[model samples]
Target: MQRKFLDYFLFDKKDNGMLETLYREDETSFPPFDTQEVSFYLTPEKRLSLKYPAGEKQELSYQGFRDNITFILESPFAEYFEILGSPYLDLEVRTGAEDLDLFIYRRAIDENGKTVVLKGNHGEPMDSFTRGCFRLSHRDEVAKDFDKVRVICQPPTPKSGVVPGQIYRVIASAHTGLNMFARLGHV
Candidate 1:
């Protein structure tokens, strides 16, 4: 999604430093999961829709799911905020009545056991086609006391998509550490 690191600050996760996910100039293949499906697809509208329900009732599409993970790891905000490979990234996927299981994954590997995206310390920008405006919500899905920093997004509601309603509480953790003037400087 489009983002600007308004304020500059260094966040140390202590010994647990974050890892970044990279995007490739060349289109890469999707990852594989053991499942039977009709078709897995991701649209330019940032909507991910599949033809039919795969055998995994509790899970989302295998290949296309990876694309979303790829988008998040490569998002500009992720890079600017330096939140790539932390303990784990919680991506609140928005789907149309679909319960899918996705991961930040240590590496991007295809079904054939070949590495597609390698693990690294640098975050990459998400492809323009798949990126969009991201707004955070007030409720924290993962508790603050938890060891990992979980990034949560609203899943697409059947009626209005994934966009949040009024009273959205943006991620305040970063804002608290940033100086207002420094943030304005970036603007």
Candidate 2:
């Protein structure tokens, strides 16, 4: 029998309002998997938080492009996460109105050192609770070793359409392994 390991980290408004992987694990040494890091600013009321972890690799460069406003997750062991029973990274967004759209992309490098990107398919618009989820698996076997997940928010194109001083809350969570079920049964 093989021993399965599941690791997960939760991000919230606490801890100085920053979601980061720094010091959470030793990246210099051999790590079981790559740790996802996110740096952002949180409002005093804690209703709004913005994170931009994609850095120079950002693909969206339109007229309203804002730096450090997107979210990125770098996962090198995505296959393991799927085998453990938790394959998707779930993200929940809350806003004052229903005028927000989420764009998801997966970027990875193939064996030839070429870049491959995949876009997500969002069906219907979100209702009261704005939510979206993306898979970590890659379509190309050569680039299946790891995955770069990007999450961006598309505000209403018309400036006047958006609510003034509206607060947006984004919550990200995932089930790492089978242990999650065990913990639930015990509770």
RMSD of each: 18.3, 19.9
Q: Estimate every model's Cα lDDT from 0 to 1.
A: 0.28, 0.29
The worst-scoring run of ten residues by lDDT in candidate 1 lies at 178-187
**lDDT value for candidate 1?**
0.28
Summarize candidate 2's per-residue lDDT along 67-163 as a digit string, tens digits.
3243322222223221222223333233343354444322233334334332222122222112233221111221222244332333333232334
Q: Write the per-residue lDDT of candidate 1 for residues 1-187, one digit (tens) a residue.
A: 1222221124433232223422432314322232222322333333334443335433333354345433211111111211121123223344332232232322322334343432122334221211122223222433243334343334443332234223222222211111111111010
Candidate 1, position 63, lDDT: 50
Give the number of colliding residue pairs in candidate 2: 0
The residue pairs that clash in candidate 2, if any, are none
User: TM-score, each model?
Assistant: 0.20, 0.23
- The best candidate by TM-score is 2
